[model samples]
Target chain A: MSAEIEDLLKRYQNYPNVVGIIILDPFAIPIKTTMEYTLTVHYAALISTLTSKAAKMVTNLDASNELMNIRLRTKVHEVIVLPSENYIIIVVQNPGS
Target chain B: MSAEIEDLLKRYQNYPNVVGIIILDPFAIPIKTTMEYTLTVHYAALISTLTSKAAKMVTNLDASNELMNIRLRTKVHEVIVLPSENYIIIVVQNPGS
Candidate 1:
């Protein structure tokens, strides 16, 4: 299993144009890392996946600055982004069943 | 939502003795960050969760260099630990259904 994990990490490390990549659990902890990942982007990705999925499964995504977000706060660990940017933030919920 | 994420990050950061904390997706990406997480330990957390779950659901976690591991390769990203060390590696499989 450890050998397999090494191989998997190498494969993801070679992602094209990647800067940093990280792997964590639902609570937002490190699982893996690559060039395409960083402290900032890692959280963004988790949030993005969680929020996006949660919106569909729990609520909905918003666009306007003053709009409602999904009910993913509980299911997800939480992620923060820039103050005034249109960068995508996605979140995915892991059903513990 | 953004504010909520910030609060969550701060709360986790305050974890006693936490070196760093990162949140990522199954693809081995990041979602959030804290103090008690690192590149190696983060991966360990993911692997630990994944392999543990996979072992129970697919196979089981072994404790020998020349032993068999679970069948979590497909559902998990991958994680590696020192060959000579018995550090825990957890992996969690997210059922796509």
Candidate 2:
């Protein structure tokens, strides 16, 4: 699983603006990270909470649909969140290409 | 304000995959929408709640940082949330190029 995740991160690294990537468990425990700094457990947990809540929000509105990815962009950075069955991948990037 | 929002929506419409746009007050009241279907008040409120929670989470970790935008993509659609001082704009789009 780790090797597969590393490969996935490598692919994302090729995309424009991508700077860092972090993979986490459902509980928000860090699985692997390509970030310069280690991600804090508290931050990971909060990110997981946000993803779960957003997924729930969608589910409540349309039972047939499921969430696949989330992206947040600020002036300085962009963050993408991808949630799967048991894992969540977060990619951080520069705002523009 | 409405005219300004309409202009903004028009600009986003030119972006790839963009299908709809909705602008709402901080209270989640619909200010304007360009979607085919009218968005329910409940849905807007839930979106606002999620944004607030996410922003708070960020603040707890880094006091100086503020959330500017959030985007979510599914197999069929993508959602972007942009929060400002008094309003939140959500853009819906098809996934992929």
Candidate 3:
């Protein structure tokens, strides 16, 4: 699983627009990150919190519904969050670049 | 201010794919909602939390950066969150429709 996660991170890192990628645990702690330690930890904490809240929001809206992804567009970046079983993956991209 | 907000809500409600719209205060409490009471409150709480967190994430990533918008795509809905100084506007749409 670790090797697979490493491969996944490398794949995302090599994407044309991708600037950073972080894999986080259920507790929102970064397991792997292409960014600096401080930045990755910050992202892990904030993005994961939002993701869980989003998942809950979906479930409460309709029992059958499920959260797929959150795409946050900022003035300088685009952040994509993908939540899986054991870890959550977050990617920061330069959409205009 | 309220009348302007009402007009804004009405305009959004008239959009092509919009299903529901909600306005939330800074505290994540619903000011007005096109959806039912329970659903609106739920959205207000969850979406506003995500929006503010996202904004902070952007600011922390770079002092010059600012959050523009968040688009959360779920299996059954596309939620667009717009955060402003006084209020946050959330719109749920069915992109497939």
Candidate 4:
């Protein structure tokens, strides 16, 4: 599972301005990370909270629809969250690069 | 304000598979909508909640970093949330054209 995730994350590296990638469990525990910069567990926890809450919000509305991907962009960076059944994949990138 | 929002929404029509757009207040009240399909207020409320939570999460981590844009993509549609100081812009588009 880890190897497959690492491979998948490598594919995104080709994209422009991709700073880092992190895979977290539903509880926001960091399962894997490719961050060159420091990414604290607190950050991962908060991100997980955000992802889970968003997923729950969507699910509550329509059970037929599934939540696939989420992206948050700031002036300096863009955060993309892809939530699967068991894990969440987070990609941090530079916007407009 | 509504005219500016309408004009900005028109700009997004150029993008592929852009089905609709909605501008909501901080509380998720729909200020404007360009949806040809039915989009309930419940959907907007949940989306607003999601955006606000995510913004708060990011702010808790780094005060200097501002939350700018958030995009959530499902199998059928892509949801992009652009949050400003007073309002949140929600754009719904079809994936892969």
Candidate 5:
């Protein structure tokens, strides 16, 4: 799993405009992050909570539907979150770059 | 204020893909919604939480930056949240429609 994560990190880091990547456990604890420790932990916690809330919203609207992903765009960056059963991946990028 | 909300609702309802619109107070309480009552309340609570968490994440990354919007895409719909100082507007749309 560690090897796979390392490979994933390298691949995403090579992408254009990619700024940072964070891989978190099911509990939203950062397992691997290319960003500074403080910022990484902050993002891990908040993004996981956001993802869960979104999933709940989806389920409430339709019991059979599922949440695919979330794209949060701020003035400076675009944060994309992918939530799977095992882990959640957050990628922060500068879209204008 | 009520008249403005009614106009906003009417305008968004005429948009190409918009399915429902929800206007919420700063507290995430629904002020006006085109959706059913139960669904409106559900969306108001969860989306407000999502917006706040995302905003916090933005500020954490860069104290000077601000969160502009959030686009949450599920299998069936796209939920767009616009948060302002006084109100939050949520639009649920079928993008593939």
Candidate 6:
């Protein structure tokens, strides 16, 4: 599942007039959670800035609740607004222990 | 309403082995909100640090299932987990606009 998303992101690089592209692991992803879409937008911006691509605009992450999460519970925090999303994008740090 | 909480905080100085004392405005209060109690606890610590009082201990805010908000809505965002507190201690910044 995560691999497939990465593959799709890679395809973004082949198109002409494209910018840099990278995928984010929503699993245990670190986020302020309530920044609406800024975090995702920033991720795209970071990708373009670090790589050689003619991209200056960020394509939106269509995080309309339908494409977030569907499995995992305590491993996933309580879904903040299931009325909005089936799965949640939780904020987790890199496992250090 | 807010005045009462401040008065109670002032009385804390009279008790021995107290640290700092300060009240928070749940309204338009700047907080990370999800820190559970750290932000509130820090407020007390900061108060004790500056004030000359026999306080080195902190108390808890009795924020259980009550004593929150009851009226505001859009002025308030949708209640996150009303399965818990009726009035949420929203992470609001000091209103400047």
Shift in Å, residue B47, candidate 2: 1.5
**Lowest-scoring 10 consecutive residues by lDDT in candidate 2 chain B?**
B34-43
Error at A73, model 1, angstroms:
23
- What digit string (tens of lDDT, one per residue) describes model 1 on residues B2-93? 56546645664554433443444344444444423564354544444543332232111112212123212121121111111222322222
* True-vs-predicted CA distance for residue B29, candidate 1, Å: 33
Ten contiguous residues minimizing lDDT sum, candidate 6 chain A: A52-61
How much is the lDDT of residue B50 in candidate 2? Answer: 88
Docking quality (DockQ) of candidate 3: 0.68
True contacts kept of each: 0.00, 0.66, 0.93, 0.86, 0.85, 0.00
Best by DockQ: 4
All models: lDDT?
A: 0.34, 0.78, 0.86, 0.77, 0.87, 0.26
DockQ of each: 0.02, 0.62, 0.68, 0.72, 0.66, 0.01
Regions of model 4 farther than 4 Å from truth: A36-38, B36-38
Candidate 2 lDDT for residue B97: 60
Task: Residues B1-97, candidate 3: write the lDDT tens digits.
Answer: 8997899899898877899999887788888888989888778877776787778878977889999899888888999998888889899999765
Q: Candidate 5, after superposition: displacement of residue A36 in Å?
A: 2.2
Candidate 4 local distance difference test against the native: 0.77
Clashes of each: 57, 1, 0, 0, 0, 9
> Candidate 2 at residue B37, lDDT?
45
* CA lDDT, candidate 3, residue B41: 79
Interface RMSD of each: 16.9, 1.8, 1.5, 1.4, 1.5, 21.2
Question: Could you give candidate 6's per-residue lDDT for residues A1-97 as a string of tens digits?
Answer: 6565444545544544332332433232322222346544543333222211101100111112121111111121211111111112222121122
Q: Considering summed lDDT, which 10 consecutive residues are worst modelled in model 5 chain B?
A: B7-16
> Which has the better TM-score: candidate 1, or candidate 5?
5
Alpha-carbon error at A69 in model 5, in Å? Answer: 1.0
What is candidate 2's CA lDDT for residue A6? 77
Tell me each candidate's TM-score: 0.23, 0.83, 0.81, 0.84, 0.83, 0.17
Candidates, ranked, DockQ: 4, 3, 5, 2, 1, 6
Pick the lDDT winner. Answer: 5
User: Could you tell me the TM-score of candidate 1?
Assistant: 0.23
